[model samples]
Target: MPTENALPQRLTPVLEARFGLDGGAMFGIIPQPLWSRTNPPDDNNRIDMACRCLLLEYPDRNVLIDTGIGTKWSDKERSIYKIDDQDPGMTDSLEARQLEPADIDDVILTHLHFDHVGGASRVDEQGDIVATFPDARHWVQDRNWSWAMNPSERDAGSYRKEDYSFFESNPDAPPLKLIDGISEILPGVEVLPLHGHTFGMQAVKITTDEHTFIYLADLIPTTSHLRAPYVMGYDLQPLETVEEKKEMLYHADRNDWILFFEHDPKQAFARLDFDDDTPRAVPVNPDEISAIG
Candidate 1:
């Protein structure tokens, strides 16, 4: 455990929500013998996944990275994804640290995927969709907003209409603030747009005086995906994903950056070690990193 003094007010991981996804779909073209070795599947051939989100506490504002799949799933959808409804979500995670949705000043969505943005809104008493963090200004990449609005046929199925309808339904008071290119949405917190997983998907990079943490959103959902060629089948541009992974891995390895994975079930974050010029993912002790004074 880290001493309170060493903890950074600027970076924290919250809402450790778990779900089950098809093992084959996760690894794409990778043989079961290889991917299954790292993430063993259950009897249903589903592998456990974590929809981990991070909380950024700045002097001026409190920001949430991505909202995990919330409580809006239908019974069938819940069972299909093997979503653990009982698992404490964003609300509980925040309350544990003496906070609430109203306390969050901003929400930065990497993309509008149901899993990543589902928790951003909820059904109200009148059965109307409302912002989950009513007081916060949500940020999203402009290009992604356009892409999600008019999604390609290849990825149209992955997106749920209800998941993002809130953005459209309220034009007068749009909850989202569209960002352009790579910009620091917050002090020391920058968004880098990457293509492949989804158009205009932005990865959050957080830097402090002593350490840096890069939230790898869906670009690299798990540590096992460190391989340059292990691109997700869900990615629109598989080749682009491979190339981006290679470049990102090289930069991360060189800088010794802590790669925070969004869908890794067991490992929250990892470090890379180079062997024969190949960068390999190595799980690091979350406890070891909790304190970085």
Candidate 2:
């Protein structure tokens, strides 16, 4: 959002797309009639979920945090979820921000859930597994990476074998760095691990000279789940999610941190403005947020 020469491109971050997908597990204990209004479901009963991906263009590298539900899908799976792939798929969304797939120098995986890591692999020229970020070092939490690599049958759908194998198959795969706690992936890019959404579910935090924003991965998927109790039913440990949110939300509100959501279709980024009773993440347009710092 900066003027042509105001600041370098990479240091000035700009978030991209905000469109919905299908997800019923998000509703959780909320009643169908109430939740349905916020997100109408397809004939298959899957709710319209969002695939909001972030872009951070630094002088040294162009980083993409998560790739939402990609183009590769079986006709059966497509029919079940009512996929609209041939239209504005993930690449098209990235292109809207004047970015091409080849420009991405780093792909950060919050966790290897199908929705989050769907675009990590592409059909290679020889019809084999290959890294989508051919020039970028792919990152994953060691704990979550292992869990995704050897997933239980219950969560098997979350881990696509071909996608995971793509990293393994490429022996020279650009350093698959897996670190713990807070670590810098890029000059101003750091990742923080927050449990509950998945084990070692990490959030991407980018700090500029004057402002900082944390891309709250699956920790707070949609704006609807901003409430501590409004957790995803698919979480392995829902109580842990509640506690993590309780701690983070308070600090997030206090410090005025921008909670850039991954799955909020209508909102690009939101800031938590806490009230006495319930906290609120008032959504801000990309243009408004870009003017900050």
Candidate 3:
């Protein structure tokens, strides 16, 4: 186990891709008049979303929290999602930091959703799908992997076979390590499994001596979802989601943990304010944290 001071030296938000999703589905039962106030929808009823990933820099290794949606979409699919990969995208973000895909030491996948894990593999010049981080070990929950393999009809469309099929088909691919339950996959890094949005979806908790950070995957996709009732319609178990949010938010508020939102288009990090009837997220600048350069 790593001591308190042995936590990551730096944290970087890797902006991968920009896309859009149905605002109605994203806000669940929230009235359009309410949600549209914050996240205005496009003519197609889609709201802007970001596939943000986190990069943790340690003394000996660089760990990536998630791989955003990769470059493997057809013209029809791109138009539907309003996919945009050119502006400060994954490759450009990495290059700006003087790093390459091969430099990643480990990949902690929050879940196997197409938008989350699509960048894990890519279609090479030779036209073969292969691991993007060839040298890194990809970590995923065992139950989530099983669920992705045989997804329910409700979310079957979210799982793209081509995005992850290379893991099993390619013998020479990087190792895929499936973990069970809450486990510390790295020093000072822990993963907690939440099943409301999707079976076995994991949220990462990184602890340091001075501060703690929680990578809120789809559990709390955006700051607008800080309210207990703002669960997404895509969630299979809304009640479970509410209960889970209550517990997570209680701890987060009590501990003053900074939350990293994956799908929030405007805000990347925030601290909670529970003084109001509906919990509010106070936006925190990523540059404010010395360790999060």
TM-score of 3: 0.97
Which clashing pairs does model 1 show? none
Please give, for residues 94-141, the per-residue lDDT of candidate 1 as tens digits: 887678898998899999988898888888898877788888888989
Candidate 3 lDDT over residue span 154-252, tens digit each: 899999888877889899899999999999988879999999999899999987656799999999999889888899999989999999899899899
Instruction: Pull out the clashing pairs in model 3.
Output: none
Quantify how close model 2 is to the true structure by its C-alpha RMSD in Å: 3.8
lDDT, candidate 3, at 202: 95
Model 1 worst lDDT window (10 residues): 1-10
Worst 10 residues of 3 by lDDT: 1-10
Model 1 regions lying over 4 Å from their true place: 1-8, 171-174, 290-293
Q: After superposition, how far is residue 85 of candidate 1 from its true place, in Å?
A: 3.3
Order candidates by lDDT, high to low: 3, 1, 2
Worst ten-residue run, lDDT, model 2?
10-19
Quantify all predictions' global Cα lDDT against the true fold.
Answer: 0.81, 0.71, 0.90
The estimated TM-scores of all candidates read: 0.92, 0.87, 0.97
Q: For this target, which candidate reaches the highest lDDT against the unseen true structure?
A: 3
